[model samples]
Target chain A: MPVNKPFLHGQFAKRGIKAAKGITGIAVLFIAWQIGASVSGVSSYFFPAPVDVYNAFRDMMHKGILEVYLLDSLYRYVVGVFLGSLVGIGVALALGLNKAIAAVFAPLVGFFYAIVESAWLPVFVIWFGYGITTILTLLIFVVAFPILYNVLAGIQTLPIVYVNAARSLGATRWQILREVILPGVLPSIVTGFRIGAGFAFRGLIIAEAIAATSGIGFLIFDGAANKQTDRTIVGMIIMGLLWLIIELAYLRPFERATIQKWGLVTTAEQREVQ
Target chain B: MIVNKELPKISVDNASIAYTNQDFAEPHLAVKDVTLEVSANEFLVVVGPSGCGKSSLLAAIAGFLTPQGGSIKLNGKQIEGPGADRGVVFQDYALLPWKTVLDNVGLGLKFRGMSKAERDKIAREHLALCGLADAEAKYPHQLSGGMRQRAAVARTLANQPEVMLMDEPFAAVDAQTRMTLQEELVRIWQQTEVTVFFVTHSVEEAIFLGDRVMVLSSGPGEIKAMVDIDIERKDRDLSSLNSNPRFQALRDEITRLVRQDAA
Candidate 1:
């Protein structure tokens, strides 16, 4: 089976109603924001109306600044996350597969996990000095830790039956890893990606706020520096919208397909929704 | 007993199973040195109390574990590791939950380099043999415990292994289903000519299925006795064989051995 057939038709129809209700809720929020801004008569520097933020988005799109910054931010997000997750999984398998290696690295992983992202910014800036390398390196370490930890936990949690069954079926060590271990842990890996992606996005913005010349984060700084609250609010809204779209359109479907194929998710009722 | 002149399928020599734990926990030997031979197309059942290493003995023969000492050989060749010639059915009906009945049976064929059509053809044949043809589209969770184990048996049979190792494969199901499965299994075993080494704690199950029942004692399991079941051999009518006086006598003998070992 191709495994990617669109979910049952009933799912689409049901979601259509849910989507309609969600849109109605968003509309109410938009109206409230507009009315509150108008009544308060706040300076544009303090609070921009939804209309003013939309107009700023339109103006930035025309100037092409929004496109450049958004593209730049996306490129970094992709590169940093990809590199981070790869290194994370490798280390996780190393530690998960062997007790000796786990003992050596567990303490180091724990120590770094305790140091918050914000605290690392000063040290990283001092070491690499304001550029893509420094930002990406910081994002890699920050994003890699949790993914590594979760993957290790997932490996440890694997049922003994899977290994015994696979081995009995004539699967060699490498074959067991390729067919059984990897597939078994893939759901947790995706879960790690979901969590790590969130952290990496936050780290990217913080890094950009201090270092980058362009990006959504740079736009926030640029707007605030110029006292253009409309542009800053637009940037923030765009960031939130992009994350929502990526999760819904890409990551969520990918996670569901993998979890289903691996037979990890058992509830048939909920699977129909996938 | 009709004995065809053929080489013994597998031979075990003084095998002892022990565990050593340095960093993790306490270590203990579970099964003492044991020797046995299983002939081609023979049904050998090993029965014992809990913690007797009945499962471990099966695991050793399946190459999932290395004995602390002693050797296992297949048709004059030393058994090095798990191979396609041997297939195992587990107690838990370890059917891949993600795969439909059809795909689960076809998985071994996939590894064998068979074309999809060939794999599907062979899988369908086995599924039909187990009376699961109509349920090919259903997942493991959709099937009953009996049906799940039937699918598991079909999966092992699809690989065309020369020997089948079953570790309490019917223990998890209800009595009615277990009886049905046992009858169906004997029918399949007769038709396929596959040698079977079954492990169980149930003496009735052992006497009901085996040509020879090997009894093992508790912890550090060792062969206590072997009883030959030479009851009427109407292979297809195994469902009624339960009522045979000879079968009952053999069952009682094995039960006495188990109780004696426990005492």
Candidate 2:
């Protein structure tokens, strides 16, 4: 007699199991933490339980403090990343196409890329003063270099045969740039955007902590300084959750739609064993 | 025989091609003092050993590389750069990985500012001709080697060039697929009036494809010999060529000429 397998034995089952595993891991951590907080003799202010953090989140939400701060951070992040990406891609294209310009600017760009964005925060604050301008400048600075470098590398490493083929097919210089060069470097552009966005996220938090009066970073720093440790934990948890949401909802889907669809890069599921 | 009274479709006068790079102390001369003429609608195949300048000569004509010495002209006019008049089918199918086969085929027309519907219609015709009708929505990476080369050929043909420059186009395909592609190529050439300038290392392929075969010597290549194959176009098939006495004779002569230079 043949063995009968269960109905849930394929892709859907596998995905369901993976999700369950993730939720179970988080549940285990929360349980352990709650148990430790209850048994320890330390004050709740220094080491708040998960329930205290949840209550703090509810209190902030009721007061509309969380909403305002979240929106402020989101606005800065979106605008800074948008402007930085546009500038980075534009400058890379201009410099990449002109050998003379690239020769002059490449080393200069490399110098700036090596210096961390945190080091520039003080200088930016002096130049722009502690507000949106200072924080935006830091965010843009943190975001542009990686994108510029990756895009330039993409342009340099593009196969010459594609250009030759396009030329022979009667593509004009402008058409070649639009049709061939742009699409050819799209994978690299996506990669650079991912790195730049991640950097901008971290930079936003740091800039907010030091320079801005309203944002998640400010909430975290202020809560800790005021001895509202539960509020600080709430801010930290929000930051982590926000990053996960961005990765799932935006970055991963964008990757799947472009490079993965084009078969330029393989997904983890599709990766072959060597 | 087709009369050659009119000016040749393409004329190369003492062309020399050289590559100057920092890695090399001196410029590497690829093709040296080469002169050749290809009449309109003629299928001319160039064959040689590795390191021979056959491909460089084709590149010079395609206007990818400028000849350091002489001039290559089309219809008695000087060739300056890559133009719509001359199309190339590369050995490695250079189709855009991001675009579908239909989009790739219609790219030239799109560059010319043709409307999408009009270009797609024309692209579909060429795709059908190349037996890639089913693969219109597929990417280049999704196709087999032979199928990709067929798409490359379709893309070039859709552009409607006067001359087609093929640089070892079938070199990467399997033997079975190569033979099929060769036969299909001959059929495609007969249906069109475009001149074919093909470069390859295969002697039998040269004999089977070309009206005239030009042999090039190794290193800084120059034409060693030019032989005319008097066989009829309809009779030239890979399966039947082995039994033909004339085909055998021409193959032996050309193989000996190429082997002599190889030694």
Candidate 3:
């Protein structure tokens, strides 16, 4: 009859099994890849085995190339995403609060959102010219639109009752904005941030490939150009692993602390029913 | 018992409410030429059928809507907009999901720039008053409908408003919970001097909770009748009221008035 204790244990057991299955899957893939490369008789440059890629990873770590490139990539990602998210939230609140301003700018924001971030990159490179400025601009552009759109959507869907309740509770306009509007739209802001962060990650790699002399994007590109295929494979693996870390460590915890804790997801579902 | 010892707390004269629908060129009139006065500390209940503008009338008093034709005044001051002087308890229990029950109750004090320690102390007192002392740290989503409404009531009461505007506050809860809440509300009203203006569609609710019930006719709502209940305050519980002759007569008369408008 004690449901909670057993349910918690069951959750832990389920997680353990899932982790074990994931490790097994990777082990199987690595063994198959190693065997296939050895039997194929192709040059390791063309089809490097898992062990060769591991060697290249060790080689880069010894030479400090991986550390430097990773730091550079992380710096760009943090600065770009932070600035973009601020701008997106700011513009969203400005337009969302005022009808006249929203009417004037909503269409323009939509028009820009329609154009892909990649298209803007060439123009950014032309304007800022092949450096951190161009890359940062591209990353910011990629991150802002999704966040802006989602936050606007959040503002639109927010219930009027919350505002009315706050007003009657003696909240000033500024107090309402701080206490009511911002918190009400927080779930949407988190959703937008997740999407924007993904787009920024991809944009960083592409921008570095085209514009920068450093970062993981450059490492991957330069490796393939110099016929160091194992190093290219190492860079690709790092990219995938880095994203997993960001998702699990940063995004998921943020969601767990805020939106999930507030039970806004269930609240949204209830609103839909109404 | 203290119905008219002083000036009327809220006065409305020839108030009309209309709404402009995008699809319709003509503005839909919800309430027309309504005039009413609520005395200090009076428990006034507005009861009517659907589309009777009972809610519109409450909204006007709460300052969410401005009466197009006439004026609504509170304590001889024109009601310009919403203020802490007049707190509203909504039907949906508009406690912020992100805030704990204590924080929601303390929100008005927070807006007044009260210290967290001071606000929390006051908030806890109100939570205890509402029988929600154990639920102070729980979020709104964690509370049941009745509890949520109770928290909302505590929230408005904590703000120390002169008048409490309740727009069908207990309508969303189950039948049993509604009865319990109604009794608790009557008890709470007795403890505080805050005047109550409650709106509902249930005639039984009107009779059991209100000192006087004002019934409104159907759309473009006008006052159909005003009935004063003679049941003793001590006999206004679900069990006692079920057999009280005065309670039954008032319920029947108000039900007939509401049904006539619906018909």
Candidate 4:
């Protein structure tokens, strides 16, 4: 046991270091691919070399094409998520607060949630025509369901004592929602938002590619049509990079901070102490 | 029988509680035909074995559960729903996890429509009184078991309820912490003049804390015996009272009553 104690601690340290290296190793692989492509002298026709894509990226930036498309994509993403989240949360809260509302809407939300967001693209395009309205609405509809459903469940599942305590202290229904229910459901809502954002991003890109032009999606599709693989590669790279930035630099950090601050993630020790 | 003629802060008259769920063969009768009068500012502790309906009586007083028969009147106003006039400290701390200690304490004040500053001031006073001033910014999870219960006490106390109904509030804490909390509670009750109707399973806790201890019989629970502690309120600290022969006698008597009721 004495020998095994040090061995186990050492094993843990080694595993921690390996996990860190593995993450950086993935970035290293991407760098290696870029170098290999540039050095191999592969003509820009086939898998367009990394330098070719970089040049294409630079040209688009210089022409202000990149900025315009990026801004448009961002706008759609933000607006769609915001509007979708509002409706989803509102409906979820309504359902969570009243059983009658839940009985009426839960099945409807469940059925729609099972249907993929892309399935609506064709109908939306037919109804609204190939425009921002169709894309944004589709994205919102996709994102809204998950957020509402998860939030509703989370709010409903709160320990009965929490509400009873509040009511005993003279908290009105509104106060209970604002003070207790909202905070209780927030982490799950964020989880739903993360899931929703992934879908919205996918939906936005698909919508852009299928119809009117002006996004990273359009950039890739148009580049492929024109047989400019360099442009296509650059578009793909930018899409990955931007989504990574949003997810890691923005969304992940926000979620982590929120969970740290207000999360009810409890351990056995904390429960015992409390 | 010269019942103390002081105005009853709470009057329970032939109250019986039965759960109205559909699946049961018979409605679960938690308490049956129980009547007691809690005097103004009196520390009345009800003790019984598990399932003896001590907590049910407290719940009825708190208006969390409606009695199927008879009534509970606070100064003769029938309690139809929960009100701020009667604060409750549950066995489980029940502090809102998302709320800071200060916010949790001030929750009732917020409902009363007090200004943030006013609520903060009152919350701070109660927090300080509960010896939790340093923990005002902490969440319930960060606090110790004793601290959380103290915070609960502070939260209830901050509401300034005329009658405080505590359902085994110290049961969740350890023995040492429990003893400390009992002393603090007694001190608070003395200072505030708030009537406390406490329910406990422990006979020693009942005898140590209560001005009058009521030993309740099991299921369809009734008051089997009542003993009034004549110890001077100021001298009734946990240590001094634990060693007091009369405290021991009352504890033994209540223990015997509860055990006999259990049999």
Candidate 5:
């Protein structure tokens, strides 16, 4: 009647345990880093202590530098990832639905996939120059590739039964794409999103460090140049925490609700072997 | 509705299907020169050994495979591809896992441009008919194997297809559940004037459920024999299937034909 309440309750309990483990794991790492710094007798500039880093975080927060940089980095990341994933999924559907178009783009996609992010960086800088345009463009370019590959893979890996059953039910081509293909590929889309989000984070930092004037990446660089190691350490910790929070709060729950929880759609590569 | 009692619903005329290969491997022949006919509203069951190409034959009828040799026709019109008039229940109950039972059942209706409320109402009716009254909101994975198959059946029935193609729809279920589903399927078949082409490996199941049973030979499947059960007019009693003398005779005859691999 209600789709098995006990299973849902059990999943909740498992999630609690997983969250506890994650918290404990982060706490242990922090403690180890503090101990290692103290034992090595490293200068505060070389390796700032936990308290020093915490104080730096507090000072930056008070001065509002942290807030501006954090917001700047997050805004770029959010917009870039969203735009890139949209383009990626669009291309994937194109390739998936039609073989002739896929044949034409297959080699191009492969070649572009082989090109490194840095390879495009130099040319992009020349075209867009050092500013939000260059950074945003670079971030989107880098983020879109992985999602494109992943979504394409998702499309290819879809079960044949889904298509056959839908067609048998008299679904037209467009109807099949919307009703069957879209839902079938969503699990892989989310997987690609997680992977692409990770790439976006790295791309954001790199783009900021090289092209933009303010961001977490800029903070790390600015601190090093200005001999504010504590601020750099603060930046590093925030980046890790931000990614961790996003993963736990958004990506994971979305996956759980859509794919893993539904218990259908393997989305794994093995299903595509045929 | 294509409900003409005198016309054959689907006709297979000397159709042969071969699977081609791109590599050095030899192309395989799955079904060879198979011929059969299903009249309107007839529940025709097909039984054969493994690798008999029963599934391939069914797929050809569903328009997933094209015949290399002859042709298939529906209502005197040569079959081109899959259509709404012919609904298929796959061996593995191909319910879209993302959708709830209600959504999956109403999927065909959605394609037909029925409003959501009307589709859901029709879906609910079929679900109830299949003894899944309370499972309309449950996702496919949430249901047991028997329930999943039932939902698949309901989904097909809701589409109101003229011909129902079932590829061993109960093979995945346990014996008890299979028997129950078989009985339920018979009851549903009797209620509607829909023709059914059911494929199964079990002789007992074929005899218990079919008005006529078609037996196919192994490897590159061809018709071995076609047996009329003659029990369609009798009281349908699945529980006494094993003990019924006529049921046993039919089962034995079909089993013997299958064991010989030819009539």
Candidate 6:
């Protein structure tokens, strides 16, 4: 079999435009930061210039603090995302397949959904005691809700004809679930996961700062307290770089491979008109 | 056209259907006291107006919808549910968006527990018959509207169903494509021994494709007329069929019956 290109059909040029725009934005920000610092005549200890922040990042790298922090933060975030998605999709599929389960869980889940993950932090802190466990729980809670709702909404939006067609073609219940239902809701599931992951990312920073002793969030809080504002700026830069890497390496490529390739999943707006 | 008086492939005895999901207080009755007997190898075309319950009738036969009253049977046995023995082609084509043409055609047989190699051979043959010979690897979205519908027909046929239920299968295409598809359907029908129950809203389409066209009234679809096309099977070509007087007569009759009662 022939191997297809990872980025085919002019996708390289498509993403290139986005990448160029993003890089330009950062470049302009950095240039302005340098001019602003000189113009303001502010102390570097209060707000670090781009060059000062870069020096602090290098200094931290040499001391191996930033490397260890990066690993710790990434580990918790990745594991939390994985577990949360699995549970969310599993629960959604279970509820979607049975009306009784949906009816029983709908209001209960909705009630819990209204209570933000941040609200659970104080309670989780009491339970898990200000460590990876508390922070991870908050991350999972943040990620799972959006994924669960998206999966449920996706299953509901599917047209009945797809199921009817497959059934008439001699598919059993299991076959319908596997072949028709799963594939039909996949775009929505992925879309939901993306939204959930984005929400969880914001929650991750807050959770890490309050709970964990290691991680970029820990570094930011620690820098603010110890009069190391340059290190705080370094942590911020790393966070931005991490996000860019995740999108370019994971989410964008994953979407390109599946949803964009199929081009069949219509959004809610497109579906209404159709 | 002489429909052989052999065993009936499908028999709908006094079937009635109603849509109960509407917000209105009264249930909307679709078809009432409708009974149909389609024999083996018979090409039966059902024609009706917009509000007619022709689709509901077809759906009941395909085991997608249940009749409010009466029973539907296949070869003297009751149809418990949807089975591999009866295949349906939907108006949207219902081709799996993710699957390629070859895979979609072979999928029905796969569900019947047929080996991959065996189903693939059967699928390839049917795809060729439907004039989709070289397009097996292409996805449904890659194909034209006409090609997608043809693939749908091929997929249903490859299942080797005794009866093929088609509900407005060509209604989504353009006029040019619709005519070509109607012609292709006739050619394919002649090549296979399977019985077909095709429902359409077009009067001319009914005359062109069906061995016997059955017309139903507007609402609560009741059989208003059944006309047997006397034209030879070979004369169904668009060029020749246009000039055929009997074909025109049948079209006019079905049109009048469908447009009856100011509907």
In model 2, which runs have C-alpha deviations exceeding 4 angstroms?
A1-16, A268-274, B1-5, B21-23
Residue by residue across B13-129, what tens digits does model 2's lDDT show?
998998766877998898999999999999999999887888888898999889999989998889998988999999999998889999999999998999999999999999999
How much lDDT does each candidate structure score?
A: 0.85, 0.91, 0.90, 0.85, 0.87, 0.86
Query: How big is the positional error of residue B149 in model 3, measured in Å on the Cα after superposition?
Result: 0.9
Candidate 3 regions with alpha-carbon error over 4 angstroms? A1-14, A266-274, B1-5, B21-26
Residues B1-263, model 6: lDDT tens digits? 56446768898899898876657578889899998888888999999888788998888888877888999999877887788788899999988887889989999898878998999999999999999999998888889999999999999999989899999999899999988888888888889988999999887888888889998888888988888988888777887776788888877777888888436
Give Cα distance to truth, residue B149, candidate 6, Å: 0.4
- Whole-model lDDT for model 2 versus the true structure? 0.91
Q: Candidate 2: lDDT of B183?
A: 92
Candidate 5 C-alpha lDDT tens digits along A241-273: 898889778876677678875785553323437
- For model 1, residues A1-274, the per-residue Cα lDDT tens digits are 5453455556777768867987898899999999999999988779899999999999999999999999999999889999999988999999899899988988998888899888998888899999898789878987798889889989989886767766666666786687677877887787788889889878988999997999998898889999998999988988888887887788767765757654576433475488
- Candidate 6 stretches with Cα past 4 Å from truth are A1-18, A265-274, B1-5, B23-25
lDDT of 5 by residue, B1-263 (tens): 74576768899999997776474277668889988889998999988888888888888888888889999999978888898899999989999998999999999999999999999999999999999999987899999999999999999999999899999899899999998898899889999988999999888888888889998899888899999988755555876667878777887888999999743
For model 5 chain A, the run of ten residues with the poorest summed lDDT: A265-274
- What is the lDDT ranking, best to worst? 2, 3, 5, 6, 4, 1
Q: Which model is ahead, 5 or 6, in terms of lDDT?
A: 5
Query: Tens-digit lDDT track for model 1 on B6-113?
Result: 768988889897665475376667789899999999999999988888888888788877888998877757887678788999999778765688988887887666
Q: So what's the TM-score on candidate 1?
A: 0.90
TM-score for each of the candidates: 0.90, 0.95, 0.94, 0.89, 0.91, 0.93
Higher-ranked by lDDT: 1 or 2: 2
Q: By DockQ, who's the top model here?
A: 3
| Clash list (residue pairs), candidate 1 | none
> What TM-score does prediction 5 earn?
0.91
Clashes by residue pair, model 3: none
True contacts kept of 3: 0.79
User: What clash pairs does model 5 have?
Assistant: none
> Rank order by DockQ, top first?
3, 2, 5, 6, 4, 1
lDDT of 2 at B254: 97
Candidate 2 lDDT, tens digit per residue, A1-274? 1232454356459878877987899899999999999999579898999889899999999999999999999899999998888888988998999999988987898888889989999999899989999988988888888889899999999998999999999999999999999988888888889899889988998899999999998999999999999999988888878887887688777877777867788873564242
**CA lDDT for candidate 6:** 0.86
